[model samples]
Target: MSTSFRMPSIVAALGLAGATLLCTAHAQIKVAMVMPTTGPLTQYGDMVKEGVTTAVEMANAAGGVGGKKIELVAIDDACEPKQGPVAANRVVNAKIGYVIGPVCSGASIAAAPIYNNEGVVVITPSATSPALTDGKNYQFIFRTIGRDDQQGPAAAKFIAEKAKPKKVAVLHDKQSYGQGIASSVRDDLKKAGINVALFEGINAGDSDYSAVITKLKGAGVDFVYYGGYHPEMGLLLRQAGEQGLKVRMMGPEGVGNPEVNAIAGPAVEGMLVTLPADFSANPRNAAVVAAFKDKKRNASGAFQLTSFAATQALLAGLKAVGDNPAKVAEYLHKSTIDTVLGPVSWNKQGDLNSFDFQVFQWHKDGGKSPAAK
Candidate 1:
């Protein structure tokens, strides 16, 4: 009779264990990462993924949000505008309430509307085009990076004050991000009483920029600012050097990849590019930095800390108002989140209230430092 009684209790205990496991699975909060996992910008995507994953793991280790674990769902948009909406829909279909990327500006712009309509909160770590949030009151969209308009003025001021070039030329890839920033820098340079000798657009995938280099040389441009990705920028640098066009080249954050050195060879050295000031050196982020180092991940890349901060912002919103995307969006709009990037607050337009954009000089050794004034 004792054995019979024990058997029934054992069965009940097993049933309870099964139910607990089911509850644990159901209680997990899902967050999606939409970025390029394939294609030219894969390294940038890897940096963002590492940062987001590390931040989520750290959060989970600390008992998670409200005792529920956070689950990551990664979707590759290939950094292409055409693929962005497709990835956004995939996240929506999976019922994910938050997203940490769509790292490239073109992808983010394409995906923003889908996330907004579905009430899924999207916080892009690196997409900085002013068009993303300029006039759209996207309740579900936010960015950790500064807009191109803001970055443009910073670059323009630096050029005017430091480079002091008598003739400058502007080039772009004709995409939203590339063209918008080039235009902003052009306007700002003009406003600064600097002469912009040439402004043109180049096809992104073309292997040669010899024709463009000839134009720049003919224009007598001492300073060349190309608003595009590393691929074209690298080709331009290498080709310009081969053509004996001695000029200083600069670009926006899109061109701030270490891979540029491989493509441009020695020409990448001394190339100035604008990016967010490094935040990994902050003493407050020591623990986070150590965690990344322990995992063999770089916490100092262009998007790593910003992506971590984006995850933190999402988690903060979740903690404040539960997992509802709308509530989280409202919470984010009203609250200042203390994250790896330090305290951050968003304006009504879903852009950060302020972000420090600075210029860095790239080295052929795959390292970068603050540009000398």
Candidate 2:
């Protein structure tokens, strides 16, 4: 009789423990992060991850949206356009209603249609191609960064007015982000009454840009603007220096990674690039900056704060409309929420109402500051 009573009590205790575990498992809300986890751009992916992770931790600490924990599901697209749809399908299959990236513009453009068809909301922190939302009816797609068209003109004006190169050369990686921005800048330069001497395209993964460098030198190009990521830009910078070609190089935000220092060495100094205006220095973001610092993460990188804002937007939308993605999308379109990047609201095409993209001068010490006139 004693054994029977003890066995029943033990079974009851085990059953209660199992119930608690099940409840805990059911209380998590899933959000996907689609970015490159392995590739030349992995460092960029890590930055996005750091920002998203910090945002989710802070949200969970404050009690997550609708009283549930926020769970991150990271899907790697390798920043490849071909891998983008694959990652998007994985997120859809996981039943995730929200996403924080597809960081590269090419990947974002490739994945946008899939997310739209599934009614899943995706807000990219770094993809800047205007084609993502330009004249499209993508209700489920949005970005925290300014479009390349906007950035291209800013770069053009800076080059035309500030750098004032006698002959300009424009080069691109031929990918959507690279080609699109280069084309825009080229057009804007002409519009500003500046002549672009040489416009060219290069294959991205090629180890040699020496031929292009030779061409630029031959054309007497004093300033070269490259529309691509840092790997190619770093090679160009290093090679140009080695070949005794002295010319100024400028690029878009894609070339702003710190790893470029390792790739270009001292050649990286004076390289100009455009990035979203620094928001980490805002007085209102003191706490957020401290939180990143406490975790030993650099909050000042190109996409850190933008990724955090994207996560905040995701959480805010989820809190407002629960698990209904369509309603969440509608809420985001109509509401202006306070974020680390300041008050942000989206237009009908899912572009931010306003974003400030400014030029920064890179230093060999792996630091960048706003360019002085």
Candidate 3:
């Protein structure tokens, strides 16, 4: 949809490329996976890797994409927005036709234009920033994950009706993903006529948040809604407990790591967080989950199943059109992909065809398990 490119060049290139080979080459299908395999988001990246690897194995066992095996090129982006351009460039330089992930929202937004311009198909599993796809209409970019706009309203509805706290406080890491969802939640809460006692942004990667806890306690906040990954939330939980604050805490899917419980200790008990419904719990995904656990990789996390679904859509498009990136993107845009996360389709903007979200409660005191209650 970008007017920047000459239509003649695209038509010429497609004609030349199509005329040379009507079908996929016998060479292996190389797909690039961009994520933070190291650094703060290492945990989330590991889950995505597991899901993509599992699905790749399944496809290969079935004779692969257009009779060619899949070869994944995993690259680390460290979840930094500044590193997104470089990570995207590495994938493009490798000449991958299809790509999955760039786990963080800021990183995904940064890398999207480059992928779109290069005519590569990218479907992110965990990048939930509204700005990432806003006005891009990038024919090549898509996401299996729903946006904060979908999740924030679900969370606000739950908090307003279920928790019914007298007052709420919203906090975020001030990064793109965190701030986007936090702002959505704030607006929804206001719409529900719930008084948001405080709406503030906090520093990310900080070890101590006693000052923030002190302010929350002084404000007499009944519940705190946070938007960030596990690390900072863990620190806040521990600090809030240390300061004898009794307010309940809630966050988005970014706060669902087991490491959060480890860091927060028992303080995370009874905390609430929203995620896409548990895909592993679906009987339709039994085979997929078994395949992953058989390989000693945990496929039990928020985005991994969505990642699997994205790869499934990618492969489906490949089978439908023989690995043509533009056609694959077109097919994905129009087709309803049956996946571990249920039937997934896409809009013209490359976002999900529908919105889905869920809520869970962390019971660290009860052996650090989520009850989904």
TM, every model: 0.92, 0.92, 0.91
Structure candidate 3, residue pairs in collision: none
- The pairs that clash in candidate 2 are none
Looking at model 2, which ten-residue stretch has the lowest summed lDDT?
A: 1-10
- Cα lDDT tens digits, model 2, 175-241, are 9999999999999999998879999999988888889989988999899999999999999999999
Please give, for residues 1-373, the per-residue lDDT of candidate 3 as tens digits: 1111111111111121111111122337877778886787788988887778777767766678777877666777888999898888877766778888978999999988999999999999999888998887789989998998999998898898889999899999999999999999999999999999999999998888888998998998999999999999999999898889988899999998888888899999888988888888878777777777767766668888888988998999999998789999989988998888888898899989686787888877523344333
**Each model's lDDT:** 0.86, 0.87, 0.82
Better of 1 and 3 by TM-score: 1
Candidate 3 has a TM-score of 0.91
- Report the C-alpha displacement of residue 60, candidate 3, in angstroms: 0.6
Q: What's the lDDT for residue 209 in model 2?
A: 82
Question: What TM-score does prediction 2 earn?
Answer: 0.92
